[model samples]
Target: MKNTIIIIISILLLVFIFSGCGPEKKKVAVLIYDMEDPFIKGVSEYLKAFDQKSYDITYYDSQKSQIVQNKIAEKLYKEGVDLLVINPVERLSSYIFVKKSLQEEIPIIFFNREPLKEDLEYFEDVYYVGTDARESGMMQAKLISEGLGNDTENLGGFDKNGDHIIQCVILKGEQGHQDAEERTKSVIEGLKGEGFKVEVLHTKVANWNETKAYRAMHEIMSEFGEDIELLISNNDAMAIGASKYLMDNGYFGMEVDGVVTDIPFRIVGIDGLEEAKLLTKKGYMYGTIINDGKSMAEAIMQLSEYILENDEEKLQYELVDNKYILISYKYHSNE
Candidate 1:
């Protein structure tokens, strides 16, 4: 009977040891700007597929509202989440969410849309993962310059009119958006540096919505007709929208006596998404600058691991002051 009791106690001790040795599942909450944005959609998909061995992830969609984002963030904090990942709907309004999370001592990783610098400085545990907007803009101009045959005087082939000036239309994203403003200004500056005398026919704000881009492009086409030699969009969605309108109106890919006479106009965009890459491969889009979503995901995971382990030395990348993990841009060719 004593020997039986010893065996039972040993079994109980073994059970207790195993139960205590099991790793605690870290609770991670992710807040997205909107699942509607394809780039953010891709990132959210990746985050969802993250290894369950390390984290239990819960996702929340802000639906592009600051109030909704703040409310969801507060709820996540109250739930005792170990980490918070956010892609703010409106960057300028991200302070509310960041402040709340920081005050609660929860580590936050801000992806895609960047919060203000002051918000990040409030806590060392905060980080931002995104690319430099100016790089994409410069890349778009390089593609345009290359398409013009790299001849400063000739403006590549963009100067379809013999007038020696390139007439271009800008399909801008959101009006007050940081990406839109930087891309718009940098592309023009880059083009000027490439020795092209550019004449801006019109600049229209499409709010980064495809439907709005379609409507705006249609009107611009009606006014400019074939006189518009180039089209520069802040993102691939807008470029695709404008391209769709042009294709539907028989302005592009016209057949002349059984021969496909494609329009000579070049269209450049940012964000080398899969759809955009496919379009580029089909010669519909001129080219695009890659916004690396995978890199952003990797960075977020690395930062989260650093926070959880409390070992900055184990981090894959040292968090730079200001902590901007700017992903590099790759130019996707339409050729």
Candidate 2:
């Protein structure tokens, strides 16, 4: 009887040990700058829907505050998360998180809002996954030039005053955001490079908010009236907002019997959101550049997997400079 009882106890111990040895899920913490931003919200939703069997992922919103982001980072760090994917509120403040990540020996993947190059170089394990800002701006210019018939002499009837110069209004994303600055600057440069004469009527800083862009459009239209020939926006949300204002005031087209009519002025933006694509197809908006959020989410997850497994082969996206993964942007228009 004693021998039988000893054998039973040994078998139970063996079973317990085997069960405990099963693969454990890696804890991943994703920190987003603002949940309200449409682009960021789309990216977050993609991250949330990733395969959950191997990773235990959680999301934190910074509420557009660097201070709030810092606090959330600290809390996540204390909780012993294995990895961090952050879209920083303030690009410069990335250094703070980098230092902490280095000290804690945790890998980080910064996406969307890129950090300073110097900060990214501080750690070997740190990585950035995002689309090129300048590329998006250049694409925006291409769409605009094409929409206007690529004619310097006539501007495809878009030159309302027949001055051969496009009178434009710009809706800027944010004050100091790198993407915003780069996109705004590159678009203007690109147009000039294409041998098109452009005159900016007014530029309003909308901070990437649709409501703010709506209000800014109102103010701009009030000041400039019909002299505004083209509207350029840094993102689709703002473009959509501006389009709404234009439609309400009879500037944009109204659909009648499933056909949009009475369209005036050309409008273009970056970030190829679904609504923007539909609008472009229906001739409500000119064009947009695809930011490709789904691809970004996949890249971030692959990087996270590579970090957890310590296998570079796990990365599917081409990592440039051993630190960055740049996703390409494509121009979308009604072709």
Candidate 3:
């Protein structure tokens, strides 16, 4: 009995020692460009929910400034972070981040806003997680064109002006943003491919802000008025902004039954946020393409684990060609 009691005490002591001396928890630094963005906010929440508890994640909001982002990154490195997940303020300005990652031998997962492909190819320790911006645009066009009923010849519903051409006003995101450029260009191209001759009344760069989008829509309404048949935005925030303005001006309104009615102009946007989905369900917005925040968060976490653990099999399954893990968008329509 004495020997068994001694054995139990020894086992308890060993457990305490090992628990106290186990390897330090890995630290992950996540730098987001703007925390106020709805889709990004959703992604952050998902990341928190899906964390595996093996590592500690710290999120820093750069507030849409490259200098701030750089400083935050430096601070994180000084604090001994094991990995970085960056949604850059400027995609092309990733050189500084890349250099730091190389110097410190830390892995980086560039999600959402992507750096150039050439820049990505420059390092083996870096990866990008995002959907093809053009795909969102294609889906937007598909929703719009399909709603018009005719695939090619008749552009009846969309060409609300009774002319053969559809008058469109584009609410673009940040001016040099890659996603903005691609989404804007591809949507136009997709429309043309569907035989809808587009007359772009104006292209307003709203910097992805709902307030800016509201102001831009107000100004555009002053100039173009009802001549604009379709409002296409790079994100749902801008669409919401436009919708609010339309609601104030009698172009859109909620009926007695709580359904969104009186939507005269067909409106569309990307990034199917919950609020946007709710609006779509109410028949306010025509449609939106859902950016899968859950999938993105899962991929980021999986890749982070693979990097810190050096698990090549996990890495292989997480990425395609050891570089990009592109998520696909799902379409949601209220039409």
TM-score for each model = 0.89, 0.94, 0.91
Give lDDT: candidate 3, residue 34: 92
- Candidate 1, residue 139: the lDDT equals 82
User: Candidate 3 residues 40-67, lDDT tens each?
Assistant: 9889999999887888888999998999
lDDT of 3: 0.85
Give, for candidate 2, the lowest lDDT window spanning 10 residues. Answer: 252-261
CA lDDT, every model vs. true structure: 0.81, 0.89, 0.85
lDDT of 1 by residue, 204-229 (tens): 99877767888898789889867888
Which stretches in model 1 have alpha-carbon errors above 4 Å?
1-21, 50-52, 254-261
Q: For candidate 2, lDDT tens digit of each residue in 79-103? A: 8989999999999999999999999
In model 3, the runs with Cα more than 4 Å from the true position are 1-18, 151-154, 253-256, 313-318
Ranking by TM-score: 2, 3, 1
Best by TM-score: 2
TM-score-best of 1 and 2: 2
